[model samples]
Target: MSDARQYFDLPSPFAMKRGGSLQGARIAYETWGSLNAAQDNAVLILTGLSPSAHAASNAEDPSHGWWEGMLGPGKAIDTRRWFVICVNSLGSDKGSTCPASLDPATGETYRLNFPDLSLEDVANAAQALVKSLGIEQLACLIGCSMGGMSALGYMVLHPGGVRTHISVDTAPQAQPFAIAIRSLQREAIRLDPSWHGGQYGDQSYPDIGMSIARKLGVITYRSAMEWNGRFARIRLDPEQREEQPFGFEFQVESYLESHARRFVRTFDPNSYLYLSRASDWFDMAEYGNGNVMEGLQRIRVEQALVIGVSTDILFPLEQQEQIAEGLQAAGAKVEFVALDSPQGHDAFLVDIENYSRAIGGFLARI
Candidate 1:
């Protein structure tokens, strides 16, 4: 029961919070399984930065999805028992309202003209879509990384509306280091002569710029230990060095380069910009004036599951601990599952056994 839609209509101006004409930008999404008679079986799944609306099994490509490995009939998400919905972020490139979307005024891509968007705005758009679909309450709101930030926004703005929330590998507020990383990624895109301040789609989007940003992200997403084990001691001897046909490279470097190339091919530069900015600017307390505990204290969800990776410096265990402690103080039932894996922040994506067990257990409890 997998189905997808490329767009939906909303009879109103689609302007971003920072202010710009989104014109007629559309949102892409997919639904899994059937809604129960009460229509309360819907579970919203928000994707990390870089992923489109695609989330589960669909006829367009039945065998592929960003989260195909973890979501299915018998898997952790269990489409058999829940109606799952994944939507593209408003400023995202994947058929969503974004800079790349056509601007009615200019009849061209919004490009850099798209205004900045807050995490709250993205959440509001999702909420609007949900309402349009006639869903008043979500069984669960699950998100990872940037998506986690959006989930935080939802919890903050619409208390008691979501029954459960699963925040994976991120926090409500961006760390300084995270901000710096996003700044650099944004700069990388800007440096490309073709980027033209994110309007770079004439002779093809800024592939180089996007590739560079993705490479930087990969460095943070994966753990050093995992890299060491995967490509340790493998170096480019002179004979193997292919300066031209034979490139000069270490196996690890080769792996990273290949990964970067694929990422650029699949990703859109503007979407990257929008999502990254959304992630960096996401401090739930920013609107509430930097009071995180105050914000968390408002959440009335019965339960929450916080997932952390031991080696994830990006979203370190300390940050997750803070969240757990705050939630406990709020008298909410919350559990933290720290997975031991060398994959760092991305352990949630690669380390299957521990993740499967943890998720299955949680879903079972529900």
Candidate 2:
């Protein structure tokens, strides 16, 4: 298959938010559909922590993408009507300048040496890419999961850059519960001897650490209801079960193990560490006298759709209501949808029909 990924070279000596600078940095992105002569129909999608720029399939890369069900010729984010651009987060492993990427100054991977990353930096990089494409203002800005926080940063730092917004399951700040979970996840990775302070080689990769961290993430990504519904107390087949004590005896354990195995090798551990911390560090309150609602009110948009799954413990529905209320206070027409999806934080990805209906309806009116 042809590669659909494209690169945007950031201005040399890109300054990071928490001090330190990067030279020869680049961002990876992908585009679909056509830009109108007016350039006003552009829609930018800021993705969650782990997704690449390929949100949907195109002729160049025909394989289904992470958001393939929601974006297409006539899907919710219709490529036929809007020029869609999806950008890989700067610190992500996916074809972007990240911890695994070589440092041009030292000719070695940055690894732990990579400068501190923030969602603001992610927003800035995305804005720079949009400006490079000559889009003065976006018709709609869509952000899902962690991306919603990044989108808020983008709107705050560059007011009036987007005419409208879509906030999916995300929070304005990392709550205490979320911070604790992530802290444990990071601790699990660091406690593994093979991690070696982010210096482990492929042969000595932190497989067990990464697996445990991924399993933790997976546990939080969905809900207890979904788990009970899908697997319940189902035991593994006798033949499939490990023939050792304290081995895989339950279907849920096997499911998490399979997911972790698939992810641990593909993603760079250092990149995961960096991005996870960034997610933890993001707090909109810093921009509004330590108030999240006031910080959200700083963004300027004509309209917005704030969505959340009722079962999402990671980013609860109350957070979505806060976004709606704040944006409305900022004079933007806001629509808040609280979905009772058993899928939890991942409802936007799994419960596509509900998401599509809300997103498509909102976009249609815009």
Candidate 3:
């Protein structure tokens, strides 16, 4: 509400959690509503892997964002009551400094040369932005998926920066199954001849492999029940299948194709590789000598909320339970909410009303 989307320039030679640092790094972000006189009503919203800083409809941009259904004036986030700040994660293709961005040293895109990124880097960059805004504490810090992992990192890195923490449909670390799936997805891209070991400049992108990878990803993001309910035994016309070499008999296959096509046009293959690997590289327990509860002990929030979808095999309800239990064991107030839905790992994205109601109720208490 204060202004449209904006950029925050991080201090030069940006340091990373890993070894190297980046030069001229900047983060793109958007804000909604006004910061109360106390600056205590600001809410930090972190997105999953592919979303931009545009979390919801705002004055400058009215288009719907990935979380459009749950944000805005009277929505779950309720911009009318709280100032919302959504920062595009570093290494994202969307407006943030990334592999696609030019290296200030060489005047060319970093591409594969970009330093390895980690969830800590994302959390640090966001915290820098918050400090730049002169905000002392956040009313709540909320995230979904990869964002949730970042939220965990933020809680540990800056223990007193946020008062409430909300993590939705994400695990504290990438589970083995999730990592294996993403490994194959990365393999798909590298196996593409056009990918040229991530230097595919001027040549055709690895669209074929990217598409295949996305198709596989779709399966993991959704539940069997949802697929069955939506595309039960439906088949495409034989003639249409013949016309399109990649066409499939099942409507579910077509759904995957549509999403893949839409994604490749906007997402950069190298950035995808980086972000996916970053997720796998994140492990919350590393903060406290491989003990999750020990790591959680570093968190200084008044309240914590963990939400998990029953059908989410990727993140799983058990993962959320782990987070809540760890917080409680560490002497923090915690609430664990289990949502039943057919949407699987993506329930937070698709089952809007359920998530909205749960999150809204939590925010009200905050």
Best by TM-score: 2
TM-score list, all predictions: 0.93, 0.98, 0.97
Task: Count clashing pairs, candidate 2.
Answer: 0
Q: Tens digits of per-residue lDDT for model 2 on 10-116? A: 98898999988889999999999889999999999999988999998898888889999999999999888999999999999899999999999999999999999
Reference-based lDDT, residue 166, model 3: 89
TM-score rank, highest first?
2, 3, 1
The TM-score between candidate 2 and the true structure equals 0.98
Candidate 3 lDDT over 228-345, as tens digits, reads: 8999989877764646566487777778888999987588889899989999999878987997767767677888889999999889899899889887877778989999989999
Instruction: Give the range of the ten consecutive residues with the poorest summed lDDT in model 1.
Output: 15-24
Poorest 10 consecutive residues of model 3 by lDDT? 238-247
Residue pair clashes in candidate 3: 1-33
Could you tell me the lDDT of residue 164 within candidate 3? 92
Model 1 quality (TM-score) = 0.93
Name the regions of candidate 1 deviating beyond 4 angstroms.
202-205, 236-240, 244-247
lDDT per residue (tens digit) for residues 1-366 in model 1: 448655765436765566653555567788877788897888888778877777766766575788877788888888888888898877777777776677778887776667787777677778777778878889888888778878878877887678887878888688898889888988888788877776565575677787788888999999899988888878967775666865547887777787888888666687678778888877756644578766666676778888888999788877777666666677778989887888998888888777778776787787
Q: Rank the candidates by lDDT, best first.
A: 2, 3, 1
